[model samples]
Target: MRILLLGAYGFIGLAVARRLQQAGHDIVGFGRDLDLGQRLAPDLTWTGTDLSRLSSEASWQPYLDGIDAVVNAAGALQDGARDQLAASQQRAISALIAACEARGIRTFIQISVPGADPAAKIAFLRTKGEADSALQRSALDWIILKPGLVIGANAYGGTALLRMIAAFPLVQVLAFGKSRVQTVAVDDLADAVDACLAGEVPKRATFDLLAAEPHTLRDLILKLRRWLGLPTPTATFDLPAPMASGLARLADLAGWFGWRSPLRSSALDILSRGIVGDPTPWREATGRDLVELDVLLSRLPSTRQERIFARSQLVLPGLVLTLASFWLLSGLIGLWQWREAVAILPPSISHGLAASFVILGSLADIAIGIGFLFRRWLIRAALAAIAVSLVYLAAGTVLAPSLWGDPLGPLVKILPATALAVAVMAIAEER
Candidate 1:
C-alpha cells in the first residue's frame, strides 16, 4: 500500500513509518522539515507541507497524490505565533480528510489522546477532540487512536520531559501526583495503526491504545527512574498547582531559546484531570493483550546509548549554548581586543600571521556559533566544533604555553569543551 504519513519525523510517526515500511508499504512523509525527515528516515519519501496554509482540499492535493491511505500523527501541545495547535492538529487535518475523501481514499488513522472533548477545559484536548470529531464525520473509513502517555526511546514533548525528570539525581513529584495515568509504548501504538492498515482491527472504530495496567503519576516517575538506572528520588517535591504553573511559564520563556519545554500550563491542567483510559477495545482490536508498562520499559535500551540520549535532552542544548557562548565571546574579544588577542601569538610568527589569527579565527568562531543554532546541521556543526576545539587546544599549546598557568585555567577549559562537542555529536547522531 502507498501511505502518506504526516509527522513522519515525529516520535510516533517515525515508528509507524518504519513498521509500515517493514510491512512493504511505500510511504511519502509529510512534515514541516523535509531535511530532518530525510536524515531521520533516509529510505522514506518526504515533503514539507505547511499545514496552516492547507485551508482546503486543494492545498492537500499535492501531498495526497498517488497515496492510498493517510496517517496523521502530527500534533502540538502549545500555540506559538508560528505553530498553532488549531491548524496543525484540527483545521488542517479536516482539510486532509476532505482531500482524502475527494481522492476516494477510504482508510485513515488519527493519533489522538485521552480526554479529547470539545468541551474540555484544556485547549489541547479541545482541539484534538474537534479534529477527532471531524474525522468521525467523514465518509472515509477512519480509525482514531487515543493513547495515554506514549513512552518512546526517542524522547520528545511529554516523553522527553519525563525522561529528563527521571534522569535527575533527585525525584520530584507534584502534590497531586496520584493522578491516574496509563502508558503505551510507541511501537505498540504504531502497531495499532498497522493493525488498522492490515485489516486486522475493527473498521471505523476509536480505540484507546494503552498498557493493561495504569499507575499513579508518582509511581510512573519512580518506574521511569528505575528504568534509567537511577535510585528512587529521595526528596520529591510536592509542587502545588499554582507554583508548578509558574515554573512552567519560566520554561515556556526558555522556549524562545529553541527548546520546547513540555511542562506547559495546559500540561499541568490535563495532568490534574488524569489520563486513564479503557483498554478492552485495544485488546479486542489486536486480539492480544497490550504490553504492560514494566515489560515496555524493560525492552528499551537502558544501557549507555539510551541513557545518553535520555539525559542529554537538556544537556545537549545547554552544551550547544555553552559552545555558542565560547565561540561568540571569543569572536567579540578578537574583534574588540585585537591587540590582546594578537599578543598571544608566538614571537617567531609574523605580525601578519598574528593579525590573521585574531580576525579570521574570531570570524570562524562566530560563524560556527551561528551554525550551532540550526537543527538541520547540528550534528555536522558539532563535528566541526570538535575539530575547532582540538585546533584551539593545539594552537594555544604551541603559541601561548605560559597562559596555561593563568588563574582561570583557560587552556584547561578546552578539555571540557572537546568533551561537550563529542557529547553533542553523539546525541545528535541520526542513527
Candidate 2:
C-alpha cells in the first residue's frame, strides 16, 4: 500500500514508518524537519512542507493523489502560542481531510492523545480533541487512535522521564502519587496503525491504546531510576490542589510573558486528574499484551561509555595544546627576563609558583581528557578535574585575578572542563 504519513519524523512516526516498510508498504512522508525524516527512514520519499502553509484545499490535493491512506500524526506537544496551536491544527487537519475527500483517498487514520477532554483548557489537549472531532465529521473512512503517553526504545517519552529523574533526585509527588497512567510502546502503537491500514479493524472506530500495567507517577519514576542504575528518587512532598492550581496558573503567566517553564502546567493538571483509560479496546483489537514499562526502559542504550568517549575526543587536543603552549610561553618569558638582569630570585619565585600551577592544572586537564577518552576511568577523571578546577580557580583568583578575571570568571572558564569531567564520570560509573 502507498501511504502518506504526516509527522513521519516524530517518535511514533518513525516507529510506524519502520513497521510499514518492513511489511512492504511504500511510504511518502510529509514533515517540516527533513533531516529528522531522513535519519528515521533514509529510503522514504519525503516532502519538506509545513502542513500549516497548505491552507487551501487545492494546495493539499496533490499530496493525496494516488495515496492509499493518510495518517495525521503531525501536531505539537510543546513550543507554540495558544492561538497558534489551535489554528495550526484546524488548518492542517481540516485541509488534509478536504483534500483527501476530493482526491478519493480512502483510509484516514487520525492519531490523537488518549483521554483528552473536549472541555480542557490546555491548548495542546484541546487542539487534539478538536482535530479528532473534525475527523469524525469528515466523509472519509477514518480510524481515530488515541494513544496514551508513548514509550519506546530511543524515543522521547521514556528517555525524557529518565533524564528528568537523573537530573532531580527528589521530585514532588502529586497528591500522594495517586494519579496514574498507562503508557504504550511506540512499536505496539505502530502495529495497531498498520493493522488498521490492512483493513483488519472496523472503520470509523476510535480506540484508546495503553499498556497492560497502569502505574502511578511515583512508580514510573522509581522503575526508570532502577533501569538507569540510579538510586530511587525520594518523593519530596505533595502540594494540595489549591496550591498546585496556583502554581500552574503562575507557570502559565510566566510562559505568556516569555519565561520558559521547566514543567508544563497542562502536564501537571493532566497528571493530577490521572490521564488513564480502559485498555479493553486495544487488547481486543490487537490481540497482543501491551509492553511493560520495565521492558521499554531496558531498551535505552547505556550512554555512559559513549558520552565519555565523546567528551574525551573534544578535550584531548585542546588540553595538549594548552599544556605545551603554557610551558613554552613560561620558559620564553623567563629567559627574556634573565638576559635583562631582572631580579632572578623574586622572578624565579613567581615563575616557580606559576610553573607549579600550570603543571598541576595541565595534569588535571589531561587526566580528565584521558578519562573522557576511556570509559573505564571516567569517574576518577571527573573528580580529579573538578577538584583541580576548583583549586586552580581559587588560587588564580587570589594570586592573579587580572589573568583569571573575577572568582566567577575563573569558575565559568573551568565549566567546560568540569562538564567534560562530569559526563565522563557519569558514563564510566554506569559502565
Estimate the TM-score of every prediction. Answer: 0.81, 0.67
| TM-score, predicted candidate 1 vs. hidden true structure | 0.81
Global lDDT of each candidate: 0.81, 0.65
Q: Which candidate is the best by lDDT?
A: 1
lDDT of 1 by residue, 1-431 (tens): 99999889998899999999888999999888788888888999988667777878888888877889999898878775346778777889988898899989999999999999878778899999998999999998999999989887777877777776667655555535788888998988888888889998887889987887889887887788788887667788768768887877866654444445577766767777788899998786577677889998889888776676667775665787788787778777778998887877787988888998879878887887777766555667777777877888888888888878989987788788778877777766432
lDDT of 2 by residue, 1-431 (tens): 89999888877888898899888999999887687678767899998576667777888877776788888777764443322565567667777788888888879998888766457677778878877887888888999988887866553433343344343444534442677878888888898888898888789989888876788876775665565555445555566778777866765654543323324466576666675777788678767677777777777564664333333433443453343343344345544444332332234346656555455555555445544333334345457667866776676566555645555563466667556545534432210
RMSD of each: 3.8, 11.1
Off by over 4 Å in 1: 21-24, 35-48, 80-82, 119-123, 152-154, 170-176, 200-202, 240-243, 264-269, 281-288, 299-301, 327-401, 405-407, 429-431
Native-vs-model 1 lDDT?
0.81
